[model samples]
Target: MTGFLAAVLAATVGAQAPGDGADQRRRLVEQKIRLVDILINSPAARGAAEGHEADARALIEQGHQAVDDARKALADGRFDEAAKLADDALRSVSSAARRMSSGEGALSESAQRKNLQDLGDQVGMYRSSIEELAKDPQKGTGAKALLRRVDGLTAESKQLAEAGRLGEAGKKMAEAYKTAVEELSRLRAGQEVLLSLKFDTPADEYAYEKKRFASNEIMVDMMIAEGRAAGDKRRLVDGFVEEGRRLGTQAEEQAKTGQHAEAVKLMEQASAQLVRALQSMGVPVF
Candidate 1:
């Protein structure tokens, strides 16, 4: 049952643990399933069942090709690009799901049974993927709430599929997937912000980075802002540049090592240091 869901998951989720290519393979499967769904929804699908079957087969083939492209991207460390390929495959699948929700391919009871079973399988696959993700120390990547959210949605989808209600199940699944993707994007952005703080000479903490070269204090006044990783107070002059760059490097290293949140925190510190140094020099960092 989990055969196809695994593939779609690969595309939707962030990069896997360095060694687990299995996750990538599974996402490819999801793409293939989606391609089948697309062909089934095509205009030619309903009029001639034979034509629909052939087209479905072709879509499946195309989906596999897309998965391959995504897998290569993943292995190459192009996480953002890999994510995009996965998105394309997922979109293909979603398109088919939308058609199904609209009752495009109203099938006989026997066919519906086969289809529901496939959906059930997909649900199972998603559940497994979620479980695997749970093992990662990071609870949530961006929104810091993805794994829990996805798990709840996966469970609901499984129940809907089991009840032989593919349309409702698909809709719920779609929402869940969308949420996960949104969170992933957030996580990426947050990682970019980790450990870095910027100050402009012309601005206080409340007026940070207002314009291209706005000035701010070297140390963060707000608890929401990142503070120095070590020590307290601001640099008297441009003397803090070394400390700031050190923090930035640490943040980048952490991000590269998959401690995305930690990396950002370190980076913010570094940025703040640079801000003070630039201000002392009477230069703009923007």
Candidate 2:
């Protein structure tokens, strides 16, 4: 893409509305574009849009390592080492953005803009997701608050996306994912909470302990108790089917990582979960 288009794109990103609605705008961007669309539509900017993002991932991976080291440095009071590592990671973000916006880069301006927009939307999705999760009764009120960090990131993502700076946006996404995982790791899982979540149904509990298949008695009883419950069998079946798909995907990931034994165990668990999720709604799961 031409310099004029790139400038215009950056300006548009700068004008993005900040707040919850920004996330909805981001989701729209994802539904609208792809990486290959960059190469095909804007040959001049393709490298900046696509190739630089891969480079950014490598940088972010290095940043993760540095952050790990930085933690140790902080604990040991090695301030210099911790500072250096943090600076390195921050520089990676800046460097990646610069490369993505290089005028001589091959990605077309349109492709770069679309790629950035998609990243912004994902960041927004994470931000809004965390906000909504906070309101869920099933979620822990004790979960560590990372909303402020995520908000900063959503803003960065929006800025980068509008600039058609996919490479930087990709790196930001890596950081966002890392922060989210860290936030989850910080959650304190209390014994009381664990016990509260446990199933109290005697028969189901007994069956679980024996590693035996679940009997349909409880489900049937519940259906009978709630007069119109059977009417929603199709919806219930759909939930099972969707959950089964997730378990299968996770199983595939485990296998790919060379944990074949664990993978088999997970796959078996997934199968059981799938069967439990799918049985009796009209499609037989046996």
Candidate 3:
């Protein structure tokens, strides 16, 4: 949480004084109710509900009920009851927010595991490609250093994962994957590699690019939701993602009009923008 938001929450949810007048207590309770509403309607809270996080959903529902009861108490001139109910609502809202925040942490851990798995897969793919290229001794000549670095990074990532430092593990794995990709790109600089997929039609190519673009967009969304892109970077990353979505929309329209070739190009551009967005959030993608 940011300092600004924490300060705001503190101010809104402060304890009522014993000497406070009825109107002052009422206003404080109302502020708390509004804060609860805002918290429960936030994107994270909504996502938790959508994901079937039972505890969070139940808490949010409980908060809503408390808010309703508090409003009724306020109307009936029961200031003490309204204050208590309002506090209940605030407690439920805070619990729900914490539950959702914990869920985000779990999600981050899961994503880190996936990243490690993906890095391992990319390493295998690159090794296989290198072996095939080695058939012509001249093709795989200059990749020894990069190959060693990738191996070292992959090993270190595994060690970090074993130590339960998944965040560090993911970063190491991303570095490994990026290194492998760079080496592969270097090896295939002049001639197309045998591993390159051959598409039978423009539509097939478009489908492939579209899938890639969607995957990249998903990564960008996850990073943004995790608050990885914040402050100044948030705006820049959002811009890239928005541009990517625009390009993706244009690509879909072109594809619908039987312009598969153009659609493929547009989708590729869209995917590139999404990749940039991820990179801006310090995530590596190939």
TM-score list, all predictions: 0.27, 0.28, 0.41
Comparison by TM-score, 1 against 3, better one: 3
lDDT of each: 0.44, 0.43, 0.68
Model 1, span 132-223: residue lDDT tens: 44455674342335667776886887688788775556546644544443344344443432223444532232222211111122111110
Query: What lDDT score is found at residue 216 in candidate 1?
Result: 20
Tell me, by lDDT, which candidate is best: 3
State, as a TM-score between 0 and 1, how close model 1 is to the true structure: 0.27
Tell me the lDDT of candidate 1: 0.44
Worst 10 residues of 2 by lDDT: 31-40
Candidate with more favorable, higher TM-score: 1 or 2: 2
Tell me how far the alpha carbon of residue 85 in candidate 1 is from the true structure, in angstroms, after superposition: 35
TM-score of 3: 0.41
In candidate 2, stretches whose alpha carbon ends up further than 4 angstroms from where it belongs are 1-106, 136-144, 163-166, 185-286
Candidate 2 similarity to native, TM-score: 0.28
Q: Worst lDDT window (10 residues) for model 1?
A: 215-224
| Model number with the top TM-score | 3
Question: What pairs collide in candidate 3?
Answer: none
| RMSD of candidates 1 onward, in order | 22.6, 22.6, 11.0
Q: lDDT order of candidates, best first?
A: 3, 1, 2
